[model samples]
Target chain A: LAKTTQPISMDSYEGQEVNITCSHNNIATNDYITWYQQFPSQGPRFIIQGYKTKVTNEVASLFIPADRKSSTLSLPRVSLSDTAVYYCLVGAPHRYGGATNKLIFGTGTLLAVQP
Target chain B: DAGVTQSPTHLIKTRGQQVTLRCSPKSGHDTVSWYQQALGQGPQFIFQYYEEEERQRGNFPDRFSGHQFPNYSSELNVNALLLGDSALYLCASSASWSGPQHFGDGTRLSIL
Candidate 1:
């Protein structure tokens, strides 16, 4: 398991771009960076995932450097609904090839999308 | 195509008592993991089950136990509960060992 560190909180206005960075200096070669968004009283929703470089989805984008030590989650055009805690998780492949998805979540970055 | 589902969205129990939380994994998922989340804090992993067996556990005490049924559903049991046990209990299900795990809304347990 790799530990990740992200900002405790970030503030952004609506229609602005918000980037949340996570540092995982000990990330392994088989590890992949994943981001999740959690709203109050709801379960965390998967936003984007990336092994390296950049991966864009319908909702967000994940940017990972070649070192694999850090990654950033970019959310374009933020809205009030985007106000939630964002979690950065480093997924390490297990011996079984990709069947154990156990995750450790630290206090995630609270992105407050203000109006 | 329903996602992961948990029963008894909310529960209340007194100290020294026991409570059981149930979870039905997403279709085709075979692994289930449980987590505890206190107020103003991120979720803490409790344990995980694969192939109907306990595979990994976190820092939770022996009081926190779980079982995975043949159908991939799971039950989280907490005995001798204390007020500190009052938190949201989360259940996540994954298709493989390293892929993304889907989660349920969670069961909010309040220990009195």
Candidate 2:
């Protein structure tokens, strides 16, 4: 399992963009960087995932450099509802090609979106 | 389609007692994983079950054990629990060990 480091907390106002970076120096070649969001009393929700370069979804975008050692999650137009903890995980692929079931979560970046 | 569902949203237990938490995976999901989250901390993996067998485990002790049934529903059992065992237990299910795992709201266990 690859360990990830991210900011403990970030503050943003409504309509602003937020970018949280995660460092995973030991990320493996088969690993995929994934991000999740968690609101209080709820499970973490999948935001975006990418293997390299950039991937964008309806909610957020993931930017990974060629080094693969670090990645950033970019959220546009922050709102109070977006206030939650964001987790960055490096998915360790199983020898059989499927990703590992074990998801290691760190403290995560708690993004407080102010109105 | 329904996502992962866990039973007994809240539970109260005492030290040395045993507790059981249940989870039903999302439709078509064949693997279930358990995690424990302490207040102000990220969730820690407990173990995962596939094919009605314990496949992978984390750093959790033997006291924290789980069982997956043929239907893919699972049960987590903790024996001789301690005060430190008080936390939120979350269950996540994935499809064939691929893609993102859907999670339940988690069972809040308060050990007194």
- lDDT string, candidate 2, A9-115, tens digits: 99999999999999999998888998989988888888888999999999998999999999999999988999999999997534263324589999999999888
For every candidate, C-alpha RMSD to the true structure in Å: 1.3, 1.4
* TM-score of every candidate relative to the true structure: 0.96, 0.96
Model 1 accuracy (lDDT, Cα): 0.89
The regions of model 2 sitting more than 4 angstroms off are: A93-99
> How many clashing residue pairs appear in each of the predictions shown?
7, 0
Every model: iRMSD: 2.0, 2.1
- Model-by-model lDDT, in order? 0.89, 0.90
In the predicted model 1, the residue pairs found to clash are A98-B97, A98-B98, A99-B96, A99-B97, A99-B98, A100-B97, A101-B97
TM-score of chain B of 1: 0.97
